[model samples]
Target: MSQGKLSPRQKMINLMYLIFIAMLALNMSKEVLSAFGLLEKKITNANVATSERNVAFMESLSTMALEQPEQYAAVKRKADQVSEISATLDAYLGDIKRQMMTTLKAEDFEDFEVQDQPDFLDQR
Candidate 1:
């Protein structure tokens, strides 16, 4: 039967089919999945690096407390500020990563090669 003449049950089935097709399309698109994986990996690495740095900083703080009690409080205060800044930076990086992923089209990840000369100026 024509779509215009479809009953309620047929319409519902058609809607479901559309949704299923859309989901399949998304899953089959390598660019979309690659983008998702790239962003997820970056976030995981960032968390790992942050944890490692914080652990090292805490160790240094303990050593400082034993060797230089006077500067310990100052170091602790600066560490707190640094931690806050790191958190903000992480959030900003996450947002940028997500935006880039969403904005990238299928052609963007086709080659997936880094430039010969990486842009150091873009780091900041």
Candidate 2:
């Protein structure tokens, strides 16, 4: 038979093959998209947490500066160091998210919560 000729059985089989291929394509695309979303979310959350920590530490340093001028320089230095470390950690998290597989979801990360350190007066 010519290439144009197809029996009913052959047509059915071809249709089934096409449907199967489409489903596989859809599933794989979904997985890839989800992976990208997961990575984006992780990077964003890490960035936000680091930013909050930096702000809180900076505020604490400023408080120390106001309360004890004699220790202002030391407090400022420590705050700077903390900021740098936090920035480095944020960058590393971004890199890890970029390299992680799709199977790693947002649930894998612990919730990012900042706890305020107790002031000396509060310890009494």
Candidate 3:
């Protein structure tokens, strides 16, 4: 392993080593990207579940308010306010996502295979 000129066999071994290292790096990158995609999907699913639960809870509040207006009406009003705010925020965030997709020229962010430019977002 001297710094001096090496034999052809040694040079070939070094080139192979370099190639192997590059391959490992590429494989690791793909695995990391896959993990990120899976995480995003899990988070999206959880958000959907949470939204469903919130809707169910809101419905129950509506029922309670109708059944006992004296006690639950105020509570229902507050709940309705929260729901309205949530809807507004959700719409704002959705608009932001649409803008991002438009800027990226992406049909679907979940389709990682179609995303070729890793630095597209960075450039913006």
lDDT scores for all predictions? 0.70, 0.66, 0.80
Q: How do the residues 1-124 of candidate 1 rate in per-residue lDDT, one tens digit apiece?
A: 4646878998899899999999987554546556766886798889899899888987889788778879797877787788889889979987875655444455653343321112433443
Instruction: Give one digit per residue, the lDDT tens place, for model 2 in 70-124.
Output: 9697878777887798779968976754554223346533321211122322444
Top-lDDT candidate index: 3
Q: Could you tell me the lDDT of residue 112 within candidate 2?
A: 19
Q: Candidate 1 overall Cα lDDT vs. reference?
A: 0.70
Would you list the clashing residue pairs of candidate 3? none
Clash count, candidate 3: 0
- State residue 89's C-alpha deviation in candidate 3, in Å: 0.6
Clashes of each: 0, 0, 0
Q: What's the ranking of the predictions by TM-score, best on top?
A: 3, 1, 2
> Higher-TM-score candidate among 2 and 3?
3
Considering summed lDDT, which 10 consecutive residues are worst modelled in model 1? 112-121
* Model 3 poorest 10 in a row by lDDT: 112-121
Q: Over 4 Å off in model 3, which ranges? A: 1-34, 105-108, 111-124
For candidate 2, what is the total of clashing residue pairs?
Answer: 0
